[model samples]
Target: MQSMSTLVFDADDTLWENNILFIRVVDDFLAWLAHPTLDHAAIRAVLNDVERANAKTHGYGSRVFLRNLADCFERLNERPATEAERREIERLAAALVFDQVELMPEVAATLADLGARHELALLTKGDDAEQRRKLAASGLAAHFGSVHVVREKDLAAYLALTSELRLDPATTWMIGNSPKSDIIPARQAGWNAVFIPHPHTWELEHAALDPADTGVLQLPSFTALRGHF
Candidate 1:
């Protein structure tokens, strides 16, 4: 049997559908605004710009996303957006965080199997209440021994969590899709990492992993983790 270890997972796209829901809201908002001069791609660029900047200043969550959408509308829309349009943005944001999202294939089963042998935990970055809401909705909270929500998932935060949990960097593993947040920083923090790439991960989370990132394992899917752990 493999040695028992701590397995920390990232919540959003790493475990379940997240950005896709936000994408839907963006598409809906774009449709409503229908910028006269710009097509969807051009219009979305404005929103993307807003998100990237706002993420630095405001951090992240449904509320921030909703605000980003409104801000983008005001920036791009030739005419002033009506209160109805603003309300619609709020509705979409509420629906996303307030409802249960579909978990990735084999997530529950794989987490169950791993949790049986390894100490499982969560290290995800986002707005605290929204992340908690998503975790509570996911129905996999019991599998985790601890959960951490942070404003950012940089190397410092990783180090903080490692110290907080008293985890052995040699034996603990970080499992998730975001190369920027989950894989890179965790490895830099001296933890083992397993990368399960998700096609729908947020654009902001994309970062190329160092080809020589030692102790980093890439798997085909979440269920494939059963083979390694």
Candidate 2:
């Protein structure tokens, strides 16, 4: 690690507890459904399929996700969802999103320590306004010199960001929990990456990195960065 380098961070599970909130809502939804024939795993498969398919068209956010759950309910129940059911789903989705922005252990202090010497930036992908709202509520927004909330974190997006920021790929490092979105793509974009694994990361964000990419450094947790940077 070099002194005063640009450090790009993923906003969700890396910096704070994010996926767990959605998981809690999904648990509640499954319990409420109470399908007599389907086991929890079976039910989840259907819902996961629905979410995967809908993601392309609807994008991600509480509003889009709640609507996808409603569609999943209809797909499983064989009957149209009632107004009450829709409202209940919305109520559950509302509980997360902007309400809970709990930072991961030692994240605030670690970021504070790193921010003093490094150029901190935030790069997260989701619904733009919703992601910003969460960042605003988190109270860590001020630490970042710039923030980017994109629809997706693909190779092109990473390259575009590097160009836009006028960053040197050799000195810029991306730190995050998602290998698929945050690690692999950032590495492919020619930036060094620090991967801090999260146990309960969202299933869709999991990927095995190619052994050939030697630019990535793996750390056990967020606070460990203080030792390296």
Candidate 3:
């Protein structure tokens, strides 16, 4: 609420299209499988399970996503994949990882507006190289005071960042799409949180906020965020 507030923005869905890209890749995989009897919903459910399990072991990014698709197919089919099928999956995953980063509508103007008014920083979680690549490609990097790439978005991670930067929790704000990662953890750290919901937010990133916990401010979209400042 203060003019000098330190604002941390999540880089993925908050600034650009991330989860939707993964969804598109998954759809392509389903089409390639072409299983007449298998329900798409069931396969997606299995794929989600595989992704979570594999994330714990292999961590996140394109390679882990490819492995998840491969493991899910094998689990459902009860057989090893053919060389051609493996190649197709690898090609699709590579395309996704290497694809140009696309910013959300009005993101550039919105970030520019906010950057002029406050201390803006980027706080994103994922493979360091992948996150940096996306950030660099976004072309909005110059607006930020600092950029942080973390393996996870949790209370401890935020705390560590704040400590290192010497930011006061009382005057800092975290703005992002994920309630599980962006809002809750920021609020828990005694900082302000603004939730900007994205349609394709990953299921693993979803969480319900208590009605009594009215600290988090929810906006319909990123463009609307400029009004708050």
The prediction achieving the highest lDDT against the true structure is: 2
Model 2 misplaced regions, further than 4 Å: none
Pairs of residues clashing in candidate 2: none
Provide the lowest-lDDT 10-residue window in model 1. 92-101
Best-matching candidate per TM-score: 2
Task: List model 1 lDDT by residue over 1-229, tens digit each.
Answer: 5799999999988898888888887877788776778999998888889999999999999888888888888887655568888777787666565458789998999898998899999988889998988899889899998999999999999999989999999999999989999998999999999998988888888999987877899998888989998
Model 3, 115-226: lDDT tens digits are 8889999999878888888887888889998999988889999999989889998788899999999999999888888999999999888998765776788999999888
Candidate 3: how large is its RMSD? Answer: 1.6
- The estimated TM-scores of all candidates read 0.93, 0.95, 0.94
Off by over 4 Å in 1: 78-80, 92-94
Q: Which stretches of candidate 3 lie over 4 Å from their true place?
A: none
Candidate 2, residue 163: the lDDT equals 94
